[model samples]
Target: MLMHSVSGVLIILVLIATGYWLTVQGWFDEHYSKITSKLVTQIALPCYMINTITTQFTRGHLLKILPDLQFPILSMTLLFGLSYLVQWFFQIDPHHRGLFKSMFANSNTVFVGLPVNMALFGKASIPYVLVYYMANTTFFWTLGVYLIRSDGQTHPGFNLWQIVQKIFSPPLLGFMMGIVLVCLQIKLPPFVESDLHYLGNLTIPLSMFFIGMKLAQMGLRNIRPSKDMAGIFLGRFLLAPILMTILVLPLTVPNLMKAVFIIQSAMPVMTNAPVVAKLYHADSNYAAVMVTATTCFSLIMVPLLMMMVMRLV
Candidate 1:
C-alpha cells in the first residue's frame, strides 16, 4: 500500500514536472495557460463528469452517495467558523480578511483533488469525489464569493443571479445532467459516449499542465513565511483532513469514499482564489502565493496522507 501510494503521487508529480519544463522552454505562456484552463474546466471536465457518472454509477449508487455530501458540507462550514477565530487570534490583515476566510474554508476539489483521487483510488473514486466537489462548489460560489467580494474596494450588494450562474458551472451542470439521466435510465448514443471519453481523458493531464504553468509563472520568489500563510497551511493540510476524518471514519460508507473524502478535504486552496481576488481588487498576489505554496505542499502530503488513510480507513 505504501509503495502504491508513493507511486501514484510520483506519477502526478512527473506530469506536473513536464508542464513546468514545457513552460520553462517557452512552449506555454499566460495566454496558453488561460486557454488550457478554459479547455479543461469548460469542455473536458464537464464531459469527464458526465462520462464518469453515467458509466460508473447507477441510480442506487447516486442515492447512496447523495447523503454522504453532508460530511464535506459540514466540515467546510465548521472551517469557515474556525477562520474567524484564527483571524482574531492571529490578527490577519483587515484588507484581505475576507480572502483569508474564503481560502481557509475552500479546497481546489476539481483541479488538484480530482486528479489526486484518481491517481490514488482509480475510477471507482469519481462518485465520492463528485460528492465533495458539489459541496465545495456550492459553498465557494455562495458564501465564499461573498466573503472575497467584501474584501474589494467596491462592496456590491449580494447578487443572487450572479451567484446562481457561478454555482451552476459547466462541470457541475454536467454532473447534474448525469444524475438526471441516471434517474431516468437514459443512455447516450455510442458515438457521443466515445467522444466524451476521449475528451474526458484530457482533464488530468491538462489540469497538471495548468498547475505547472502557474507555478512557473509565479516562481518561488513570491512565497514568504507569515502568520497568514501559516494559518492557511494549518487549515488546509492539517485541520481540514483531521476534521474530515472525524466526520467520515465512523460512517458505514465504503472505505474508499471515506479515503477520497479525506484526501479531497486536504487539497490545496482553490485555484480560482487569485482570479476572484484580482477581480475584486483584493490581494491577488497573496492568493496566488497561497495556491502555489499549498499545491507544492500537497505533493509531499499526498503520499503521507495516503499511507495514513490506509491505516485509518
Candidate 2:
C-alpha cells in the first residue's frame, strides 16, 4: 500500500513538472488555464463527484462516516480562530487577511485532493473523501467566501438567492442526489453508469493540466516566500495536516477513512484561490504564489504523511 501510494504521489509530481515544462515551452498559457478551469468546474468535477456518490456511496457508508465530519469542522474551526488571532497579533494587511485565513482553513478538497485520494485509496475511498469534501465545501462557500469579501473589496454583496445558488452548487447537488438515490437504492442502467464512470475519469488529468497552466502563468522564478507566505505554508503543509491527523486519532470510524481524512486535510491550497482573491479584490498574486508553493510541497508531504498514517492505523 505504501509503495503504491507513494508512486501515485510521484506520478502527480511528474505531471506538475511536465506542466511546468510545457508552460516554458509555450504550450500552455493564460487561455489554456481559463478554458480548463471552466471545463473542470462546470463539467468534469461535477461528473466525477456525482459518479462517485452514486456508484460507491451507500446509506451504510454514509451512516458509518457521518460522525467523522466533525474532524474537519473542528480542525478548520480551530485553525481559523488561530489564523485570525495570529493575523490580528501580527497586524496582517487588511487586503490579505481573508486570503490568509482561507489558506489555513479550507483545502483543495474536491479537485487536487480527490485525485490523490483516488490514487492512494482507490474508488472505495470516495465516500471517506466526501466527508472532508462536505465540510470543506461548507466552510469554503460560507466562511471562506466571507473572508475573501471581508478583505473589504466591494462585491455585489449577497442576495439570498445567490447564497442559495452558491450553497447548492452542481457538485453539492450531485452529492445530495447521490444520497437520495442511494437511500432509495436506485442504480443507473449499466451502460449509462459505465459512461459516467468514464467521463468522470477525465477529471484527474484535466485538473492536473489546469494546475500546470496556472504554474506557467505565475512563472516559477517569481515564487518567493515572504513572512506571511511562510505562515501560510505552515498552516497548510505542516499544521493543518498534523492537527487533522491528531484529531482523528480517537475517532471510531474505519481506519482507512481516518487516514484518508488526514491526507485530504493536508492537500495544497485550493487552485481557485487566485480567482476568489481576484473576485474580492484581494492579493491574487499572493494566492497564486502560495498555491504553487504548498502544492509543490504536498508532492512530498502527502505521500510521506500517508505512509505514516498507514502505520498509525
Candidate 3:
C-alpha cells in the first residue's frame, strides 16, 4: 500500500513536472492554460463523468453512494466554521480573508483527489471519489464562490439564478445525466460510448498541465511563510484529514470508501480558487501560491497518509 501510494503520487508529480518543463520552454502560456482548463472542465470532465458513472455504477450502487455524501458535506462545513477562528487568530488581511477561508475548506477533489485515489485504489474507488466530488463541488460553487466574491471590491447581491448556474456546472450536469441514464436503464450506442471514453481520457493530463502552467506562472520563489499560508496548510493537510478520519472511523460504509474519503479530504487547494480570485479581483496571487504549496506538499503527504489510513480502516 505504501509503495502504491508513493508511486501513484510520483506519477502525478512527473506529469505536473512535464507541464512545468514545457511551460518553461515556451511550449504553453497563460492563454494555453486557460484553454486547457476549459477543455478539461467543459469538455473532458463531463464526458468522463458520464463514461465513468455509466460503466462503473448501477442504479443500486448510486443509491448506496448517495447516503455517504453526508460525510464530506459535514466535514467541509466544520472546516469552514473553523476557518473563522483561524482567521481571527491569524489576523489574515481583510481583502484575502474570503479566499483564505474558501481555500481552507475546499480541496482539489477532481484534479488531485480523483487521480490519487484512482492510482492508489484503482477504478473501484471511482464511485467513492464521485461522492466526495459531489459534496465538494456543491460547497465550492455556492458558499465558497460567494466567500471569494465577497473579498472583491464590489459586493454583488445574491442571485438565485447565478448560484444555480454555477452549481449545475457542465461536469456536474454530466454526472447527473449519467445517474439519470443509470436509473432509466438507458445505454449509449457503442460508438458514442467509445467517443466519450476518448474525450474523457483528456481530463487528467490536461488538468496536470493546467496545474503546471499555474505553478510556472506563480514561481515557487514567490511563496513565503506567513500566518495565512500556515492556516491553509493546517487546514488542508492536518485538520481536514483528521476530521475525515474521525467522521468515517465508525461509519458502516466499505473500508475502501472510508479510505477514499480520508484521502480526498487532504487534497490540495481547489484549482478554481485562483481563477475565481482573478475574476473577483481578490488576491489571486496568494491563492495561486497556496495552491502550488499544498500541491507540492501533498507529494510528501500521500504515502504517509496511506500508511495511516491502512491502520485506521
Candidate 4:
C-alpha cells in the first residue's frame, strides 16, 4: 500500500509536470485552458462519474456506499464550518477567508483520491473511491461553490435557486443518473456505455493539464506559499485526515475502505477551487498557490500517512 501510494502520486506529478512543460513550450494557451475547462466540467467529468458508478455497482457495493458516505460528508462539512468559525477571531479579509476555508474543506478526490485508492487497493477500490467522491462532490458544489461566489459583490448569499443550479451541474447530474441505473440494476446499451467510458478516461490527464495551464496563467512567481497558505496546508494535510480517522471510528466497514476514505479525505484541495475562485472574483492566485503547494507536498505526506494507516489498520 505504501509503495503503491507513492507510485500513484508520482504518476500525477509527472502528468502535472508534462502539462507545465506544455505550457512553457507554448503548446497550450488561454484558449486551451478554457476548452479543457469546458470539456471536463461539462463532458468528461460527468461521463467519468457515470462510468465509475455503473462499472463497479453491485448489490453489496450499493448497500455500503450510501451509508458509508454519511461520516465523510458530515465530517468535511463540519471542518468547513469550523474553518469559517476560526476566521471570526482573526482579522482575515473576506476573500482570503473564503478561499482558505474552501481549500481546507475540499479534496482533489477525482484526481488524487481515486488514483491513490486504485494503486493501493487495486480495482475493488473503485467502490470506496465512489463513497468519497459522492460526499466530496456534494460538499463542493454547495458550500464550496458558495465560498468562491462569496467574493463576488454581485453574487447573493445562499440562494436556493442558485444552490439548485449548482447541485444539478453536469457531473452531479451524471452521478445521480448513475445511482438510478445502478440501484435499478439496469444496464446501458453496450455501444453507448463503451463510448461514455472512453470519454471518461480523458478526465484525469485533462484535469492536470488544466491545472498546469492555470499555474502558467498565474506565473511561477505566484506559486510561493504565504503564511496563511501554510495554515491551510496544515488544515488540509493534517487536521482533515485526523478528523476523518476519528469520524470513521464507529463505522464497521472493511479496513481497506476505512483507510481509503481517510486517505481521500486528506487529499489536497480540489483542483477546480482556483478555477471557481477566478470565476467568482476571489483571490485566484491564492487559491492556485494552495493547490500547487499542497499537491507537491502531498507526494510526501500522503504516502507517509498511508504507511501509518497500514500499521494501525
Largest lDDT belongs to which candidate? 3
lDDT of 1: 0.80
Per-prediction TM-score to the true structure, in the order listed? 0.78, 0.79, 0.85, 0.89
Report the error of model 2 at residue 164, Å.
Answer: 2.5
lDDT of 1 at 28: 99
Better of 2 and 4 by lDDT: 4
Summarize candidate 2's per-residue lDDT along 74-146 as a digit string, tens digits.
9899889889877776676777888889887888886667767777768878877888887887687567766
Clashing pairs in 3: none
Flag the better candidate by lDDT, 2 or 3.
Answer: 3
Winner of 3 and 4 under TM-score: 4
Q: How far out, in Å, is residue 32 in model 3?
A: 2.6
Worst 10 residues of 4 by lDDT: 84-93
Sorted by lDDT (best first), the order is 3, 1, 4, 2
Whole-model lDDT per candidate: 0.80, 0.73, 0.82, 0.77
lDDT of 3 at 136: 91
- Give the TM-score ranking, best first: 4, 3, 2, 1
- Against the true structure, whose TM-score is highest? 4
Q: Which stretches of candidate 3 lie over 4 Å from their true place?
A: 114-126, 149-153, 251-253, 275-284
| Model 4, span 114-183: residue lDDT tens | 7777777777778778788888887786677766767664645666887687657777788888888888
**Model 3 RMSD in angstroms:** 2.9
Instruction: Give model 2's TM-score versus the native structure.
Output: 0.79
